[model samples]
Target chain A: MLSRKAQYAFRALTLLVDKYDQGPVLISDIATKKKIPIKFLENILLGLRKADILESKKGKGGGYYIKDHPSKTTVAAIIRIVDGPIALLPCVSLNFYEKCKNCDQRNCGLHEIMESVRDATLGVLENRTLEDLRTGKETLAKKG
Target chain B: MLSRKAQYAFRALTLLVDKYDQGPVLISDIATKKKIPIKFLENILLGLRKADILESKKGKGGGYYIKDHPSKTTVAAIIRIVDGPIALLPCVSLNFYEKCKNCDQRNCGLHEIMESVRDATLGVLENRTLEDLRTGKETLAKKG
Candidate 1:
């Protein structure tokens, strides 16, 4: 459903959310706890910070913290911030839109069908917040 | 939502299903019509044949055809056969199970949460068939 990068971002965010009130959590602590590579995690956190999803403090006491409440941060936001588009196809992507070279976007049945899948996927991810993920809540009701 | 291989598989399957009675449709014809790369598509069709999703003929006029009705072939089945497990996490995967190295599988909270997400994702993909996909029907119900 998500790339390795997105998974890493989610894990890192959840870890931060879990320790948000405990002052800034160090990247090393997060890497060790999550079993992710420290250097790779460093890059992910930097991307998140650049996206403003997280804030970093660069001292002995500083590590990383959420810039906003976990409840306000959706999985889709984190994924898009770290991995660009949530949609599999560039043609159907809302944030990273690009027309397929061989496609007639207006008339192609393939594009239409892919769009539905993309929308369904986005609806789920966009509505699922970090709070929901951390608390194990079904934030978005199952689409029957 | 799907890999390029899965998308190509679906297109190839649709073409075969549509022309199944017309004898095995040539790989060249399917690739041309579907606009998929010939070499990549050949490997995909071979994988499908190995998975029993497709049957292929060798020699003159040899091509491929769906081994079963389009409705019998689920997106999940095709994706799993072509792309391995449907779940993003090996720990959460049903068909391709792997225990998390650092966690106790029996009581891990992360595993429990991932299981729910995996189930939800599979519920969507497994219920969708090539027939539904080819007809451009949205398999997921609208979220209110």
Candidate 2:
């Protein structure tokens, strides 16, 4: 399951995407609108800013905004930035691979199974973007 | 990512599946062979037993064994029993559904995307059983 941080990240990102053309959005507004705790949302936004997914400005009209076009940013990228690897096993992860000492990757059934799962999950996340969230047309179609 | 407890649970289950027809295997042996911590494996095994996926014996040769036929037990079932929901979002979960305060499910892109992820993941996990893990035939084929 997604950590509250990740969920809040998604909520905040989607909100930013919704208001992308309207200039930057205040963090306080995002927190209040999305029901995210202010302090926690601040950290999450900072992480996104650091990842280059978000940009922030200072002064009177300063706030956060998506750096890239919403379509250029995938859900997989966001999740990886905020929630870490998508793979169930570190060894099967593409960006966060680590050798699992518990089993041999060559013959570990668990490893193979998780690899498939990772692929399946990435198929969805890597394809969906903030643009998709902003319009919500695809989301509504799929929901039905 | 899988929790250490969930990873250990899968390791222990696969090990038990490997020895299904060979009578009970000692927890210490499973811990050593699978590189799982002994105390952790003990608790994992007990949890499996409680879920009715495993059974134990006491006295001389007693230990743990898969309760159901390996072919009957899906990886999805084990994951749910040991690791909780496979869905990325609570709203998307079939067995562990919870409404998110952050977004409306009817139009939430994250929820829609996660629902697809859940389906894709379950597609693989529900089809892969302990028997598949034990023989490793399909796993090896896919690995190649």
Candidate 3:
């Protein structure tokens, strides 16, 4: 499952997607609608901007907007920016990984099994884009 | 996607499973091997006992043991006991649900799509068990 930060980021991004083509949206407006704290949201948006998931403007009438089209964005992208890893275990993680502390054996059985779950999890999360999530489109095509 | 508690519980249960029919394991043994904090694991074990996933004895040479066969105990059952809902969104939830805060329509497109993802996710996690994890079997079954 996603973390609170990831959840809030998705909610914020969805709000942005709902209004992206409509000029910039104030962080306050998004926070108010999303029931997230404005200060905390500002940091979240800042993180998103740093990751290039969003672009921000300052001063009056200035706010944040998606740098990429919603359809081009994936929940995996947002999750990576916010939570750092899609894989549950460090052994299977792409962006963040280290040898499992408990794994001394090169052919550790636990790692092998976790890798499968990891691949399945990443397959689902990475393939589904923001557009898929927004439109409720079944993009993966494969049945579980 | 599992919590520290769930992850610890799963590891502990798997350890017990690995030592199946060897008699009960000491809490200290599980905690040390699984790298879980002793105090926190105690609480988790208590909760697992209440859920009937495990049974405990109070005397010396007694700690914890799986109540049922490892294959019979699905990861979902353990997770549900530790984490409230498997789905990321309440609208996507199977057992626990509340209306989406911003959406008035149950037929909202977002709800429909997330539900599918949730179902797919559940299908995968719920079917996996400690036995599968222990033997590292069915690794290819999850290939996308």
| Candidate 2 wrongly placed segments (more than 4 Å) | A135-140, B135-140
Candidate 1: the clashing residue pairs are none
Instruction: Give one digit per residue, the lDDT tens place, for model 3 in A15-108.
Output: 7876768889999999998888899999999999998889998999899998888778776677888878766567777788866665443434
* Runs of candidate 3 exceeding 4 Å displacement: A104-110, A133-144, B32-35, B105-110, B135-144
In order of DockQ, best first, we have: 2, 3, 1
TM-score, candidate number 3: 0.80
TM-score of each: 0.80, 0.93, 0.80
lDDT of each model, Cα atoms only? Answer: 0.72, 0.86, 0.73
Docking class of 2: medium
Taking the tens digit of each residue's C-alpha lDDT, what string does model 1 give over B26-129? 88998998899999999999998988888888999788888887779877788899888876578889999876565555534345555655675666666666
CAPRI band for model 1: acceptable
Query: Which DockQ value does candidate 1 get?
Result: 0.23
lDDT of 1 by residue, A3-29 (tens): 677677777776787676678998999
Candidate 3 structure quality by residue, lDDT tens digits, B76-143: 67778898787767766777776666564432444544565576666666777767656444344442
Better of 1 and 2 by DockQ: 2
True-vs-predicted CA distance for residue A65, candidate 3, Å: 2.0
- Contacts from the true interface found in each model, as a fraction, amount to 0.10, 0.68, 0.22
Model 2 C-alpha lDDT per residue in residues B7-99, reported as the tens digit of each score: 888878778887888999999999998788899888889988998889999999999998888988898998898889999988889999988
